[model samples]
Target: MSDSSPLPPVRLHPEAELARDALSTPLLSRAARLARWAGPDTRVDAGGGLVDEQLPAAAELLGLTGDAAAAHAAEAWRVAVDTGLVEVTDEEAGTVAAGEDLPLLTGGSPHDILAVWLAALEAVLADATVPDLDDLAEAMDESGEIDFSRLDWDPESEAAFLDGVLGNLYLLTVTEDGPGDGPVPLPALAASMIVPGDLGEPTNDMLEQISDAMMRLDDQFRLLEPIGLVAYQPVDEALMGDPEEEPAAPLDETDVSRYGMVRLTPLGLYGLRARLLEAGFGAPAVGDLVDKGADALLDGSSGYGPLAARAETQQWLDRREPLAAARELLAAARGSDEGAPLRRLRCQQALSLVGAQAEPAVRDVLDDPELGGLARVWLSELGAADVPPPSADLVYWLTIDTLAAQLAAEGNSEELQTLLEGLAQQHSGFFAAAWRVGHPATADVLEAMGRLHPDKRIAKEARKAAFKARSQQGG
Candidate 1:
């Protein structure tokens, strides 16, 4: 037997190297800068007060238009408040104007942050153990408004949500993460906020509308994580690929109550302590806490959500497991019997689970007559998306053979006729099958072929087929 193997899988982004190299292009560099800056809300501690005018200035520095910039900052604060990341007070806003340095929020790369939230929802679904997830609705409203009074954001559920987000964040950071240094600028931040697979990129006008909604949410909820008090750190290189590395930071020490009055009670300091311990940091000795400024800068940058939800859950096998799954499914199929319909159906289902990995194995099974029909159909569907279109000669040959087989099959002549008619209409050259020599014709297929002949061999084949029809009729 001849031996050959299917080609290796195609990666869609073959231009990755070129894409990376082009990051230095002026437009992208500007995008990267903006992504860093627009990532966090501006906050300052005015003694016990809050200062926010610099919010507009910071927005301007990020090159935002007056109305657009004001709105962007509002949205940043809104995502923070909604996700339980921060709290703000007008008192602290004054402090921000006075230039007092304050603690920043738990921060990391934007992609990591976004991944945590998305994966949190994904993890909730996966953990529920459902096969298909199309039925689930989002946590927010149909009007895109978050009614904080309505949500039951209990500590346990919030913690679970946080855990899901953090786990997912870890996965994105370690596996498919990208790079951006310095604070992301506003435009890039706004652009990235337009989630992938969303209808279209958000325009400045859309950003303004989003900002307005955030302002409304802020008025209703109050910004818990005050501006100037928290800033986002640049994504470190260490978080890029090492799944096992301990996070190079710790959670902030501010009490959840310090952020705002919310629908649910914030997890207390003790809970934060337990979380830190779970994150692999040893609790500080009693004396150590005193000197570290009665305050701890929360590791606003934890990697928990993405890691657990995405990396651990999907757990893509490096090379062998998919092939192994296919082999196991196939073995189970073969032990049943050659001609059994149940066995045939099992093999088909198994091959589908094996997906592209089972292509070769299923093709081999095509040699067995019992498996041929099922295998050919699988191969056609799976292979259609992969293989280039067939040439006219191959199409012509297959069309004739398939038509002949349908003619010989006893029970479905009308269905077969419909199939042939559809094929002739869809593919211009299949008219020969519709009018096949002695079958039916207005003039003749040979004359039609002669009139349309672009290639000498095709015309000859048409003429020969006509003669063969006459011979079969005992002409």
Candidate 2:
């Protein structure tokens, strides 16, 4: 995802709801439990982790029982310390207490609870970058220090790779054409980072790199799941046993899940969006324009997909009376700027959601030079009584405006090509009069029609009309 362009707006759950989810995540819940369990008796090591002797008690307190229970408890304790859910009061004494953020989990607002969760997410993400326990053990030297060369890890690069993977996952979840809330295959996700866009076929080296990346992602996603960042299906153990083994049969779509599948949880979306915005990415959310004016709503959502735009418009409309909202939209749609046609198109869509209560507002604009044609269409669509017929000039102006909006929204699209062909076929004299329409987009629309029309004769006529229109405008 490019940081330059805004991301598709995510529809986040309410903060209070997300806070409840945050409090419910295993990692944060465990950390919170350990925080409340700590008191004067709780002792910590120099690193602020629970001392080994106290790990059993801490694990028991959290009802964890397994060979790895102590390790889990220790992991939660580290998160608590790092996120200030527990604080080391005296470093030399190695004493600990419930930190300042602990109370926020219970008594503070939903925002406060989410703030602590975000901190925990950060800590966990940092840990995910580190090699697993066995890898660390191998990297350790006789002097008990980690040999950086043996580790073969660059901290900055590892963090960046993970960030890129999560960013792509977030993009997939929020984009209209992407698999929103669906589990993406792990191989495909890894390939998104490894494969060049223009590459036709993957070589052995590229496939091997993707396989390695998948294994790393499997481990990272496992760590992330406990913190509620992803719902992961780990790579099948059978697939990992031997890198050179051949399958009995070719893999099919039905068996793809064995490779692995992952989806971002709703809570995860909220967390990642917050992180993206903090990193200076233009990550927008659906209800962001609810409090803004109609002009802002139309302008802001001009780039949104159909479903998202409708959702945003509905939220904006929910706040005001129908008649007033309709009037405001029409007023905002009457601009001569470059973006005006698309804005007007968005306005028409927004007004469609309004009820008959807005009929007066639509009727009131029937005489407006810029908006009259649009108002007539709306009224006619609603079967409003006594709608007046539009003049030839009004019809031609509306045609240019509509075509301009379509071109802006879907540049050189096949559907627009079909529309241009049908219009030319229906009206033999269209170009002759279209060049005279007073709309700002008249010449541009004619030129687009000329370029897109497949018939040479019609294309020539359109080009001629475009030249006439441009000359008439003294441009």
Q: Report the number of the highest-TM-score candidate.
A: 2
- RMSD of candidate 1 to the true fold? 23.2
**Model 1 off-target regions past 4 Å?**
1-52, 80-111, 116-318, 321-327, 334-343, 346-475
TM-score of 2: 0.95
The top-ranked prediction according to lDDT is: 2
Residue by residue across 1-475, what tens digits does model 2's lDDT show? 7789999999999999999999999999999999999999889988898899999999999999989999999999999999999999999989988898899999999999999999999999999999888989999899999887998799999999999999999999999989998999999999989999899998899999999999999999999999999999999777765548876655554688999999999999999999999999999999999999999999999889899999999999999989899999999999888899999999999989996878899899899998899999988989888999999898998899999999988899999999999999999999989998877788899899889999999999999999999999889
The TM-score measured for candidate 1 stands at 0.24
lDDT of 1 by residue, 380-466 (tens): 878645433444443443344344433332223456546644654476654444334333221233434433454566556556656
Stretch of 10 with least lDDT, candidate 1: 293-302
lDDT of 1 at 107: 39
lDDT of prediction 2 = 0.93
